[model samples]
Target: MGLSILGLSRFQFAMTTIYHFFFIPVSIGLALAVAIMETMYAVNKKLVYLKMAKFWGKIFLLSFAVGVVTGIIQEFQFGMNWSNYSRFMGDIFGAPLAIEALLAFFMESTFIGVWMFTWDRFKPGVHAIFIWLTWLGSTLSAIWILAANSFMQHPTGFEINKATGHVRLRSFMDVVANPQLWRAFPHVIFAAVMTGGMIILGMSAFAMLHKRTQQHDGDKVFFTKSIRFGAVVALVGAVFATGAGDLQTQFIIEDQPMKFAATEAIYNDTSDPAPWAVVSLINEEDKTANSIEIPYMLSLLSYHSTSGSVKGMNTVNKELHEQYDAKFGKDMNYYVPVTTLFWSFRFMALSAAIAGLASILALWFTRKGKDTLMNYRWLLWIMGACTFVPFIGTTGGWLITELGRYPWIVYGLLTIADGVSPTATVPSLLFTNIVYFLLFLLLGAVMIFYSRRVLYQGPDGEGELPAGKARAAERTSPVSAQSTGSVSGNAGGTERSVALS
Candidate 1:
């Protein structure tokens, strides 16, 4: 019954978190893009720029709403489903979460409201500042959350309390400055940027394709610039994400050698040089695997020296058991599921590679002009469909990071089985899992519906300053232009010759 409850609780948390993250990358990425667009509009005073900002801002708001709704439940689940884990690490983990809520979530929500309502009232510069603040808030929120997660991967600045059997915060700065956090944070930020860029690229491609068929220039220039901007940003994001991922791998090799070995399916210890497995067939019972490998590459990549030795999973596990067993007083399973980690790593790497190549191709096609971009129908179709690639990579990367931690909920200090809530029941966990899944399903549907509606409407609907001001100016402007048989221009300079009643 205890194991069943633990499994259910893990499933529930994983489901909720995965759903929450579906919207998070989109929200963060879109926030940055919208902020950039608003900044450009404030400086250039271009109506098209304003249109772009408002259009994308709508999608960002929808994503943010869904993300927040899904995120709120995760907090409750932490206390209810895994009370033991919460109690064990809450002292150290709760600090960053509290800061996230107080400093980041509040700031983001408040500024978003101010930015939304003050569109017509505030000056363009002030309005842009509000959106920029919102993006900054979102980024700060991510940093704090990542800081907490990093603590789980590499426990630092905390000492275990022998009396209470709980971890206590020893150095706040160490928790915040964990090497894992800094290495992982940049990768997450870059991935968010890439996700945002791909969304813009895909949506702009759709709009452009629609305009081509419909013979409408209403948003041609807007989406043209959007695609170009997205391409450049995506290129930069993909490049940085790749570099950050490499650095993160190096860190993992140094900090969590067992995870690295398991990820590569290296079961036996090797010295002088080690081969990087491209693919492997593992027999868990026998503790062996047959693999296709590149000689010396693993050593070269892991230590930056071809001659450096790389410890295998078997050696690392034995050493971990010997080192920790005496202190923890329990048999430990240090080896994570190699199959899951191995495939997830590959999926993340492949998806990122594809996104990078697509961005480069997009930049190339858009560099010449819109006409040249349109010349390749296949490329446009690919761009329009490539929006989900970053999300895939982000999801897979997260799975690898989280799952690689395995039995230990807080690295070497705590096991996940030990962290399960003693009072949790199987039926309650199962019920909540179903409920949360259905709740997110409904939320996801609504998000999709609203997104489609906004995309269909384009940027010509309400909240457009030029269109609204033009109508207002037309009503009060001199009647001589209306009464006189002559073409007249209002505040927006679009020629109009009509007699008013």
Candidate 2:
């Protein structure tokens, strides 16, 4: 790979997007789940359930803080590294993102504060209302961002600015009504939900393990329910991800055939019985794939019918299309990462399938009317696996979707070459990237440590410690004597919660 500012920008873009998404998906999914759990607890008047909701909400708060911090970098990168691409597509792209800021982000930021501190001050009914609103805000925040991204993935109805030489908005309705928005939005939300389920399962597993082995029955009762709840969500969300993901995949294949062909490394114009590239260890120079493939899979998937021709990269791209006809005109440096995208996409899909089945089985065993408590070992195993599956699936899915786009920053509207900073060379960009990457790594580490601290201090719905404990503990700095009262069984059984507040 030759070094170029565009290439470095791609790497930087990839790194930042991956990091931002890591937090956003989990926050969206977990926030919804937290709201639902709290609502159920409020109606049922179950203290344990309420306690469980409070515990998970603490973790959600941690993830939300990190999500917002990292997300700001995404908007910044557009101007800093991808200025030209932004200038070209901003008129079109900025519309939804701007709306996202005003409508969704503002709602999320404002009410989250209202929800957070109101627990002690407000009535349960009022607080629940705020919690529901918080969930609504997060969902809308995701929707608007996805709308902006979907437009980039598949540009739709827009007019050009003759004066500015940039694509401009003709109608707001067209931007909102873009067909890609319908496909991309649901897929991303479902993925977010899946990511949330994983975290729930993973944390609950740790809690379960801690409780069961040590015989902390108080925590186990709530955490076990948490595991069951997480499993159900994971199973459903994984299926949702798959269904929505396939829809977009099919759309991409049908509409962007050359894009699809290049994604699969089909160089020659081959007709009839389109062979699927499965598990190819390809030599780029020779263009030979020495790997196995199940024949006819691609044909069935793309067309919903077998025995049809799927054109290769060279044949379709070489055609002398009407440059005057393609509304924006076809001018692009043809690029594709057939091997990387193909495998990454498959890995993501396959992992989701595994996670879904595992979760379903776990849910089945868990919901067996108290009998499931006998086979606690299986929940423990599945819970451990559930925690990491979403990460793998998300990372893989992103690699497929983002890398598959190859040299385009804005689908057909802009190329990666045009997006590079004119004054900066590859080395300069690389230097900046190294600095950014290291800073990001440090930031992520601090966030994780802070999250762990938050989890340790919270999960208690009833203010367990005395009100004065915080002040006394702060003055002493990480060391506190036992309460003035006699030591009870509670102290022996439960570890002290280190309050972040």
Candidate 3:
């Protein structure tokens, strides 16, 4: 086995995937938030809620657009760089991807277009329904994608075809019901919601600060409500994310013991009650490390009992060799990069903790009696800066998940070494890597620029109505009679009604 083509392919895939994820969580989170705001508008007929929905909707649309463009490349790479793996899993893996496109993507895109154009054509309640449908589509899309990935982590309901050297699906229901899918799906969804909430909270903080300096109460109520909403959603998401992460860890310990051992830097088997390592200096060569240990915590976490035994890397590796060496004709090392996994896990945990705490503070300060909370400018600044915390946590969690899998592309079925395309060459892969890197960089830059511009504009009247509908609104509401001629125009013309055509 050589590192030539295989290593470069892994690098390229990781770079694209990480970049792609930067937009996905935000899109998913914002979609749900937008739907809630629109629903409020539908129920109360308040123009402020409509303005809120429109402002956040602009950001969501940009994220969804860029995410879709970048995601297309992932499918292509599966064929171009990892053809062998594609061939092997095609029978079982292709089904979910196909379903995502047919059932979710089309539905999301179609409703988004209708929602965008029908702003003045449909009644407010009907318009809200369109946005809700779009949100449903986006949520369904995530479920399908995660379902496909969970199969790779803990494969289920598949049988090998001896004649053709492929795995075929035996039960679609089993694939959808995989325990790992349920564990991972909620974590990803809540994290995405947290990401969206942070973005809204941060941007709202900036707007509030900017408005406060001007002594403007024109949009004060609007942005203030947004801050409270974002904070509450973020707090709930953080709490759920922590619970889901704990469940995921228990699943990991059960299904991939070697990965669990590697994550904790465990080298040698210990007694029935194992201590959890808090911090460690790993010495891979000597298979020993200096560490702080929390007595019985690992056993408690792994089995809910302090007396349960947890095997370490040394013992697990020996067992794996004895069981598979002759059958696979190779010596397998079960250890992953211990230091990287250790730090990534800690960073992810710490970030989630910070998000939770910050959200609590934000919510408390923004409450009615705690109007004094806004007087502290530094708190607002901190809340604004926390926008990136969920992104960092998300990236770290994925790194730990994918990298911890190490040699296997599909657990217990196919090794990454056996998965790369036979025609892949170091030179070809390196050139393509540069091309893809530059292409995505340009796309990412464009997405950032557009998002910033929209954020600064503050969703006043942009895209609120089509040209024809705007003309119709102009005729129906005489400019001479009202201060502003637009639909649901506010006192200072800074806010507009979000009525759909």
Summarize candidate 3's per-residue lDDT along 194-237 as a digit string, tens digits: 88888888777776666432254545666677888888888888
| TM-scores for every candidate against the unseen true structure | 0.88, 0.84, 0.88
- Candidate 3 — worst ten consecutive residues by lDDT sum? 492-501
Query: Compared with the true structure, what per-residue lDDT tens digits does model 1 show for residues 204-291?
Result: 7776676432354556656777887787777778889888988999899879987787777778887578788888898877888898
Q: Model 3, stretches more than 4 Å misplaced?
A: 1-3, 211-215, 270-272, 306-309, 461-501
Question: Residues 223-341, candidate 2, lDDT per residue (tens digit)?
Answer: 66777788777877889998998898778776666667755667675457777777767655655455565788877877777887777666655552433226434664354676776
**Clash number for each model:** 0, 0, 8
Q: Any runs in candidate 1 off by more than 4 Å, and if so which?
A: 1-3, 211-214, 270-272, 462-501
lDDT of 2 at 59: 74
For model 3, which pairs clash? 118-501, 119-500, 119-501, 120-500, 120-501, 121-500, 121-501, 122-501
Candidate 2 ranges beyond 4 A from true positions: 211-213, 262-265, 268-277, 319-333, 369-382, 425-428, 453-458, 461-501
